[model samples]
Target: MHRLLLPIDALVTLFVLTAVWLGVSSSYDPALSYPVQLGVIVSGGVYLAVAHGLVTWRIAYVFGRLLLLASTAAAAVFILQFAYQDYVEVPAIIERIGSLTTLLPNLNLAWQHPNAEAAFMIGTIPLGVVLIVTSRRWLWRSLWIVCTLVCLYALLLTFSRGAMVGLGATLCIAGLVLSKKLIVRVGAVALLIGGIAAVALTSAGSAWVLSRWDLYRNSLYVAGDYVLTGIGLGDTFPLVYSRYGLLIQVPQLTYPHNLLLSVWMGQGLPGLVIFLLLIITFYLFVRRVLRSQPRRLFHAGWLGVTAILIHGLFDSRQYIEVLWLMGHLFALIGLTAACGRLALWQPEEDVPKVFRRYFPNRLVAATAIAAVIAVILFNQELLAAWHTNQGALAETHAELNPTLRAADREAGFRQAQSLYQQALAINPVWPNANRRMGNLYVKAEDFAQAVPLLEQAYRAEPANIATIKGLALAYMWNGQLEGAAEGFNLLPDPARMAEELLTWGYWRTNEQDQPLLGAYAYETSQLMLPGNVSIPVWQAAADAYRAAGELERARQWYERILAEAPDNTAARQALAELDDA
Candidate 1:
């Protein structure tokens, strides 16, 4: 590894850890993403460590080069499959494999989108194409030409309007840099003109232009909201985008379709700053090293980095909160640095060794060891959360069991009990741990055992919506309405508690042929429904008030319903019955 590696790795690792910490510390009271994020970050950190340990730059370079080459092969296969699907018979093997792919134009998959895929290819394809010119050996040069030609054939099919425009821009720049020849330059200019005119008049072009505008606008909104601290990692951006990004209405969106904006929204300003710093470091390191490295792989590594940067403008996959997906980019950086070291050191004569002299760097060594220790020792919240999740999953399985098999259900319950115990052991007073265990006890109809756990949960997180609602409901079901009252008193907005109680009430009234809890929820909601609420909701709310013997309250609700919905015969009949009373 290069001497500069420590800082590069440090920044990237810090950014990653920061992202995990954000998830751990997110407002998710149960810290829903905490355990998963911790696992991802730790595992990703391990991969990066191991990936960098491909200490022989030559070895790492070969590994990365093969993967990049494989992408070309993948594209070619996909293009062939597309052609076959269009016309006649495809080989069963190819036909079956093609079924997994979703993007239809035959492309590299950036979120299974051809435009995005084309953008990424536009970035990396240059590196692959450059190999033909740089390779001294005819055998290697021949391979490069074949791959590049296949890649271009696929790229042409894969591209949409915006990608077409981007490709034209890239060709123009490449032509200027690669040759001073007038013919090539003029051709590049002509291609740019044709490329721009080729797609702009089409409906697809106009649609994308509008879609991208809205996406960009919404993305900017998300970025602006969390400008300083960022949106905080995990499945955060999607939610933040939905709420803050009011500009576009989307079914589901992972990113803003722009890379720099993605970093800003996910990590906030500090993350973006650190990311930029890492890029700057890569640029400076490459500048110093590129002149000395005549090796094809070394240059390819630079081009690979270039591919991501340029493609990133249109769409991003590697910068997502999912660490494994994001970590590959960092691995590439390490490989690039390693390639530089190998090139400058006369690597042909040097004996290749994995992690050669690695442990000598105490910082890296300690980081590796300390990471493990810290996760186990310090992250009590994550540890507890993992156990709690296992318990929840077990409970879900028990509930989902269709056979009503006692042994299976009992076994699942026992498994959940043990997992919850482990979670409580990890953190004695962790609110979610206590609360979930209490919920399990409630499920078993052991309110006596549930009370303390629910109390502990309420005490630990006085304002947690889930904890409050869960605890209050447990109290109501346990026939200790005072306990419910106490928990509910803490929350200024008791609507969730009321809502949960009503949900339970529905099950009791309709399913269990019991009305007590249902009546309680209805009274708690004060027979209140917005005027615009559906008739079904009003009927449910009315049922509870009637069950509670609040006939006048029920009558008032019926009158309110009949006022707006005069044609509702059910409301009129109910009102007539109430008038007789």
Candidate 2:
């Protein structure tokens, strides 16, 4: 049989596949090679519709409106989630909406991060703006206006400096290209310059700008080292950045902010080229079509796409933190690629005869098969993440999240345990899953199960405080005094765990009065506390050593404490007792 797609489609498909191949090969965790996969699925489906002339204007219109409505709802949710504030200076209305927003679960409905949400708002708000201008019904127009206003407010509230640049670009492009007046065109240029200046001069702007510079510099450095094959995707970039580059302390500053650089980081240079070629080919195709067959849909796409492009220059994290935003961006790309058909023909334009005969059926079958293969390949990691997330949500209400699951607490706990077991079975070395599952067993006082998982996590991230603390606690409870001592020694600071460690130390001390493990905990606490030896930790250390028959070590500590505090009765008494011994 003849091939299904046209030459253009075949070329685009080839580029996409090539990019995917490069992305997967170079990535540390290819399962999160998000850009290529999402693009293929979304763009391919939209292309099939367009190439077959299956997309009706009415269908396109409905989809656009639904997208606008969803953006409005999501914006509303983001606005109402005031408590988190992401440590940003939010509007005063945030305080008032706390009770209202608390009604919803924190189940990924805007965890209050603005990086992806800001870009999404930039992309989706244009649809509402278009509908507001085009809708004939007053009711529909009014609703669209409300949606646009809400999205605009939410966009500003995100305080994403990149988003502001994108908005400025959107407005300037619309004024210059869409308007007839020369005055408007000139004003657009002036407005853009002013917006840039404002963003650059905004309070705290200089700090972030400098931070971006650091990121860019380090990204370039890293890119040079792994020029042919990148460090990889997912947590790989962060890991590399921390180890080899100028790593900043900001959370989820995972990907390089620029889209091209991010692709290069994950997929190397070849993948970046392919990705650009694929996008350039399609968008240019849309541009050429619109010159002959102009329509509202194309204009709407231009406004949204312009925002993505301009914002992407300054900030592009299209993966990991927000999968839904990846879909949203790809959908826009697909829609832009396909919109010309709706304008050109009456029901829908007739596609080339070759594709018309076997277009969707053959394509869908091929895609399904590929997807099945991919699922099988990625199932272990994918399924493990899914189960681990559910297990975490069930075991404890998420950190900084007030909402808890509505199920019975005991049931939730048991379910968490079961889910974690399944996840670890599938991905035995997944650090987070192992840590959480180990914690669940620890909570049940099952020390045997907890030790190995904690040990695995410790091996993966030795510097991680939570992992070390968990491991230390498990060792202490399990009566592995040496293991417990090592963990406590490794802990940078045990100020928070001081009381608990002190109690454990005293309880486990031998008849000779020396703690089998508490000495290290006490010494570490003494080092970390503000007044290094101001607390009673020194006294406790001395007593534990004296009780352990370490007379010389106990005598030294007692003398040091007396050096700091001559009036310290306890140290004086201990020194007297040691001397008597």
Candidate 3:
């Protein structure tokens, strides 16, 4: 039993960590994605209990045990692939099993670096394995502590807000219950560290972690639009895309920053209830273990759990690898307490009445152990169920997309407009959903509908570079020159000024302001893609110059445009018109 448990715990921990990396790395694909998540959750706790048993019995099974468990997991994945033919992701499966690869940037994932999963797994699991193997060695006794600090530092570098919050919460819990002397020392250290971290965070760290907070907030608002009663499970991606649009084209609903909220949105009240119950159960179990056991190890577990739970508040990996490991830790404590109680010296009179009456005559410990093992063994089914739930959601969106496309085909403008509205019904951040919706209205020469939607999207995502550009276009479509200029100011990068100026000039058609447009255009063209695009700005300036009867300036501007874009139809025509005039 001890041998069985140790490896299970290690694998569970690894699985939990790996799942988070996977989710952050990929899109929200129910057919293939969420099982890896569910596996971590279901197995993390059970295997953790087993690891605790190994630690208690001083077993030596970390390597072979972990290998066996990994094999089991790989086999399960293979079986799942065979079972759900449609959902099987061959490349993903190969990659997942292949371990860490190189760092690669994925716009969909919050962490910009590639092979983040490999880094986290390599950094974290060996600590557990080492702790388990060297349990009896005095030198290795402090291994867990050392590994934890290392993991914490590594986690910090990941700049994952969820991880940071979770780790912080865990430390706070440890500090709260620490013995008086230790508490004082820890408190002082904490204060100093906190002060420094705060200054750094305010200055630099915030850039590392919350670079995407605004995007997260947008997902929340968008989720409410489509998920009236929840969009059903696995519906986040399709719902987000069909409802919101390309601006938010990345699959988000599956792994929102707030993991619990994503579950609530996907699975509704039942999912939320299940999720809450799981947390409460783990908390109760861990609290019981801490109060009853009173060991320094238990205290360490408390800190780890606290960090995870607290961090969970800000960044959710509820169904991911982290939570799974947390579950294992909770189970290990519970198992340790149970095993310790089995050897308790019970006085005849002091024997708890409850134990005599309700506790079993036989070793209930074995039964409990078996139950935990069964949970680990049967975890595959739970993963399969989670995948099914995800699929239902994808189908819901698949069903909606065709209808949206059909509506679009009849009239591009009307389709874009209506699709935007329907998308907002599911995801408020359907990217330029509202922008296109408004633009469609503009194209149809219906400024009224276009204005409000564009305004709403702009306000919801004020920092989004694209949304501001879209709003400016909406204003241009409505011939609102002043409004376009105001919208343009919202952009963070002045480099976008060329596009903004073009929209602005189109709106006002005022030759005098062409210099304003020309200046911005020249600045943008000098720095950006296809540098020749700036030549048009000169041509527009020439048109304006001609209108103002500044013949020499107009000629110069026209000559510049012709020099860059020799086939410049507009510039050539303008020059001819100028010569004729």
Candidate 4:
């Protein structure tokens, strides 16, 4: 047990340390949020603690039984949820045409995304297999089979192409290895073929498969630039990919979808090596158990690991805590098989002399106390920021809701302001809190207060689109044209910037500020939307030029608009008016 644990502990520690190092080295302060960093550290600690507890108790059999039971219950819940969504929520969107495959929205199931849930379910399938194979009674085997089938059904409903492919591979391997009869192997092949056909025939499924190929290609483009160190954690992908990815719409991909690539991207080469080492070690352990026992549980573990590895090639699952726990659970069971029964408890006196002398219980207690303090220090600010954002959202709802009474709307605004103040009081440096508060002020047309708050937020997360947009609008409203232009120029999407600029120009025109309005329209003219040459844009440009006494430029734009739409009455009238001028 100690031998097995030593390697696992070393690997986990290395992974966690690498993650922390990546975070520290990141150029973007919010590249890895506090919650994610803390979660990773805590997950490693929890894994170690759980493994230690399991080994010390010597209840591997009991634990295995309990795990099977829990997995079965979870599978049941997943199936129920999937069924409800498919039958109940699905019909409401029947009129919408695209892919019938997408009619059932992917089940997130407590995870951040459906892919994560699929990973969890796919990882659990092997445990069910193990239980089924090991069961003595027919009833137990039948029940395990039912549970596994339910889990598989839910996995299918997730519409996760990676999981489906992984499932096919797993089934093939399991059939070849576990089945003595040729009929069983044939049955497995038939299932695989059927699964492939089902996915391929579905409208969305084919598109999903093609998209993954494209994603991989784009990911490679990003990998080329950051080949060695890779982009540091958090949401740097948006920034990096915008600069280096394929010339498509800047995708909102937060992470490299592939598990190995994600590790490489976040932690660089050393981290990737450590991750591969961990996988290799676990594989070897599972192999050893299979060689010795050749039982249902070992085979199931092997297949489960294989399925996750295959799925991970297409999507990220390695970072998810539940999957990590499952992996650790399998490793512990393997260790129990490798090392027979041993002493369940070890006394303090029996502990190594060096450990006792240097790392005593007092030191351990102090470390635990410091950890608690650190977590409190870290999470309080984040929680406060969340509350502040929630308040801002409530204020937005109040403003948008026409049914709300004037008094109620005023109260909502006050509550939002109080929340923002509370958030700032808790943590002045909390990103988004000040930005959101500034946005609230902008909504209220209080440019004076919005400016400084927005400036502060922009300083914290300069590349954040929301911050840039809010700050730009705030600057414009405050009559700071240069600052507004600077902020607007920083926007990556030319189309969006042009639209916003045109909107601002109309607002300025209403305010009788022709010069600023003209400047906005001129800026809009300089911006180009990909694959689109809009006549309305040209008309705005012509109107601005005419207002600014640039008659020749105005005539050219009017001509251009007329060329695009020969029957455009407004353009013809504008052109005639320009001719007279």
Q: Which structure among the candidates has the greatest lDDT?
A: 2
Residue 561, candidate 2: how far off, in angstroms? 20
Candidate 2 per-residue C-alpha lDDT over 1-581 given as tens digits, one digit per residue, 9 for 90 to 100: 01222533665566456445655555444555555455544554554554444256677777788888898888888766645555354445644444445555454543656767688889988888888888999999999999998888778767678888888888998897778899999999999888767767886677777777766765775464455455455555665554333222234456788877876766665566556655555555555555665667667776787788778878986645434665666566555544654454333435555334333445446657986997799888767766775675455322211344444566777887888888889889977677777766766779788999989977876755556777776776675756765676665444545555665566556432437345655554454444555537778778777766777878888898999989999899888876786
Across 342-413, the per-residue lDDT of candidate 1 in tens digits comes to 655543433233223221335546656987887777788767766775675565446543555889889988
Candidate 4 C-alpha error for residue 511, in Å: 13
What Cα-based lDDT does every candidate model obtain?
A: 0.60, 0.65, 0.46, 0.62
Query: For residue 223, what is the lDDT in candidate 1?
Result: 52
lDDT of candidate 1 vs native?
Answer: 0.60
Which consecutive 10 residues in model 3 have the weakest lDDT in total?
114-123
Q: In terms of lDDT, which candidate is stronger, 3 or 4? A: 4
TM per candidate? 0.48, 0.55, 0.51, 0.57
Candidate 4 at residue 230, lDDT? 51
Candidate 1, residue 500: lDDT: 50
RMSD of 3: 13.7
Point out where model 4 deviates above 4 Å.
Answer: 4-9, 30-32, 46-58, 82-112, 177-205, 223-251, 317-534, 544-551, 562-581
Give model 2's TM-score versus the native structure. 0.55
Model 3, residue 543: C-alpha shift (Å): 9.8
lDDT-best of 1 and 2:
2
Please give, for residues 1-581, the per-residue lDDT of candidate 4 as tens digits.
Answer: 35434554677789778778764353233434344555567666655654555553235445555656665566555554453343322233331321333334556555334566577778778777777777789998898788787777667656667877887878887887667899998998888888778767888778777777767765764453344455555555555554334222355566667878877776665677677776765554444344444434445545766887788888874454433443543444343432321222234434344223322346446657986886688777656645664564455435544477899889888887888888788877665578767877887779899999989988877866667777877776676766776777776665567665666566555556564455454444344343457776677767876776777877887888888899999989988876776
- Of the candidates shown, which would achieve the greatest TM-score relative to the real structure? 4
Q: How many steric overlaps are in each model, in order?
A: 2, 4, 25, 1
